[model samples]
Target: MAEEKSNKKTNIGEVVSDKMDKTVVVAVERKTQHSLYKRVIKRTSKFKAHDENNECNEGDIVKIVETRPISKQKSWKVEEIIRKAK
Candidate 1:
């Protein structure tokens, strides 16, 4: 069970929204190179993560882990706050 939990997908991203109760929106950005153009491009993905303590705020950096669906849109949970918002 512990090993299976350890294999869950995780993402480090900045919290984009924290308006929902016990939920926060995290935007994870990644850089990918254009196959033909050979240019690096930035891509962002937003995820709704469960924040049991409501400790996250907009602009805060947080680590989120995949978990069982807690809501219709939330399948991720906040693991920890990496950085606080200024």
Candidate 2:
């Protein structure tokens, strides 16, 4: 039998902060319709992602993938930089 490998979860978001060494905070926003109000709403979530080289900067669009916990608040790592910050 062959072993199965599950795919990790990924998210595309903007880097909100990168003041920490080798770490960046990403803000992922999503649009969804309210269950009761039936109105579209924008939801934002903050995630702590590991940046091995600390190349991310504020306002940069990046992709993050789930991984083994590296710290108390970091369970995700920056996969790639989608867009550079202006």
Candidate 3:
């Protein structure tokens, strides 16, 4: 059997249900170590992404990635809409 390969990437985020039609909210978190202080810090960002199928709901964690512009500043699209909100 041939092994299928995918060059896709995934990002985790929080699902926010709003009146924006087929869109969900995603949060990206990053941790960096301070070079001078030698300490670690965390940074997070929330993004509004498009989910046409509504497969993901509020509080659901999902994976997304950079893609062609679906809309203004919407180059980041959902790669996989997670079924469970973990």
Candidate 4:
């Protein structure tokens, strides 16, 4: 098998809003265990990713990849538009 490519991995999130031009807001949520308490906690963060074209819309699940800074607070790019909003 060919060597698998490994780059900066990113979590998939739903597109909460895509009103901004060339920019989209993705909501990524993850569960982590507390170091001492050992209790799982749900943490969510909104990421501003660069979308070259206006291809994604609200409620769409998409994938984004980490990349060099394209603008202020923008270090990620949309990789693909996975699913459309239901």
For all candidates in order, the CA lDDT equals: 0.95, 0.97, 0.73, 0.92
**Model 2, stretches more than 4 Å misplaced?**
1-6
Model 4: CA > 4 A from native: 1-4
Give lDDT for model 4: 0.92
> Each candidate's TM vs. the true structure?
0.91, 0.91, 0.73, 0.87
* Residue-wise C-alpha lDDT for candidate 4, range 1-86, written one tens digit per residue: 89988678776999998999999999999999999999999999999999998899999999999999998898988999889998
lDDT of 1 by residue, 1-86 (tens): 45443778999999999999999999999999999999999999999999999999999999999999998999999999999999
Better of 1 and 4 by TM-score: 1
Instruction: Using lDDT, give the best candidate's number.
Output: 2
What candidate 1 gets wrong by more than 4 Å, as runs, is 1-5
User: Candidates 1 and 2: which is better by lDDT?
Assistant: 2
Which prediction has more favorable TM-score, 2 or 4? Answer: 2
> Residue by residue across 1-86, what tens digits does model 2's lDDT show?
99888699999999999999999999999999999999999999999999999899999999999999999999999999999999
